[model samples]
Target: MTEENRLREKVCLLAKSMFDRGLTGGSTGNMSLRLPDGGLLMTPTGASLGRLDPARLARFDAHGKHIGGDKPTKEHPLHTAFYDTRSTAGAVIHLHSCYSVALSTMSGLDPDNFLPPITPYAIMQLGKVRLLPFFRPGDPAMGEAVRGLAGKRSAVMLANHGPVVAAKDVEAAGNAIEELEATARLTLLTRGMNPRLLTEAQIRDVVTTFNVEWDT
Candidate 1:
């Protein structure tokens, strides 16, 4: 099979895995893959992740034009913001995972670094996740918020909404967002229990060892 066809199957497979595992429910997530030629294959606007048909995935040219397939998600601007700002981003995933959204609703979390130092994996996979303020669904302002970060953050928790992650590939993006949700779940589980967080020095070691893009 051609690379594009392989990638199309990969996208559907990963989306179904996440959906089946309850990562996102009832058509509440969107994903996109950056083709080698600089075009994009995005999940349709209202399609359920669990039931995607690879042939029907939305397609866009390098210039951001809708070249084929079903209509792209309204959150296309959100995905494009990362591609425009971060030259290395190859895929973007946005999901309304329950744990992350619950964490976003709580106060006292650091907006600049939303995920706590509860696990090295979160840091390794996600780096520092930004907790952005809530915006109405499909708001163009959400893209503006991501743009304001200047490509420093690979992930952001949309306050009271969901989490968005950009990574070097579709699988990596899926893994990183799952880690984000797991870390959020851990944080909520250990709340007020005085869970021992990884120290700053340890965090630095993880960052240095992984060569994490830890933008302050």
Candidate 2:
């Protein structure tokens, strides 16, 4: 298979796995991966991850213009924000996950940092997940919010909406977003129960060891 075909297959398989496992539901969530040629492969708008057709995925040039397959997701600007700001990101995934959305609705979570340090893995894999204010779906303002971060954050929780994550690759994007959702779920499940989260020193150690981006 050609390299593009391999990326198409990889995206479809990973996206379906996320859907089947109930990470993102029907007609929700979107994904994009930068190709070797600086083009992008993206899920179509209004298409469910569980039903993504590899042959029909959207394609965009490095200039962010659509070049093939299907119409790109309406939130294409949001995906492009990461690429425009972050030098390392090669893939972006946005998910309307239940637990993460629920947590975002709560008033107690920090506006600057969404996920509390619950596990070493969250710290190591996610760095610091930002909590961006809500924007109407498809609003270019959402991209602006991410851009304001200046690409310092790889993961962000869209208040009352979902989480968007940009990673080193498509597979990494999937995994990091999963970790965000799982951590949010755990946070809610153990609320008021005094769960044993990683200590400050522990988190600091993980951040240092992983070269994670912890913005104070």
Candidate 3:
């Protein structure tokens, strides 16, 4: 099989896996991967993650022109923002996962770091998740918001919406976003219980050991 076909299959499989696990329900998530030829392969708009068609996935040329396949997700700008700013970005995934959205709705959370320091893996997989203020669905401003981060973050939590993550590959992006959701769940679970959190020194150690891009 050719490289694009392989990527198409991989995108569908991973998207379906995420859907089956209830990470993002309905048609609430989107994904994109950088093609080897400097183009992009993206999930079509209005398609459920559980039901992506590899053959029908949207294709874009290196210059961001739609060359073939179905209509691309309206949030392509958001995906491109990562690719434009972060040199290592190979894949981008956005999901309206329950816990992350729930966490975003809560008041008084830090916008700079959405996920509390709950687990080492969250720290390792996700550097610091920025929380963006809510925008109307499909708003271009959302992409601009991500652009303003200047590539310092690999993940972002959309307030009253969901989480968007960009990583070195599809699998890594999926993993990091899942970690974001899990940490949000933990945050809600331990809220008001005053659960002991990793101290500054411990967090520093994790960052140092894992080479985390922590915004210290």
Ranked by lDDT from best down, the candidates are: 1, 3, 2
Which lDDT tens digits does candidate 2 get at residues 65-101? 8889999999999999999999999999999999999
Error of 1 at 90 (Å): 0.3
Residue 204 lDDT, candidate 2, scale 0-100: 77
lDDT (Cα, tens digit) per residue for candidate 1, span 112-180: 899999999999999999999989999999999999999999999999999999999999999999999
45-149 per-residue lDDT for model 3 (tens digits):
999999988999999999999999999999999999999999999999999999889989998899888888878999999888888998998899999998998
Candidate models: Cα lDDT each: 0.95, 0.92, 0.93
Using all chains and alpha carbons, the TM-scores for the candidates as numbered come to: 0.99, 0.98, 0.98
Candidate 3 error regions (>4 Å): none
Best candidate, lDDT? 1
The regions of model 2 sitting more than 4 angstroms off are: none
**Pairs of colliding residues, candidate 1:** none
Better of 2 and 3 by TM-score: 3
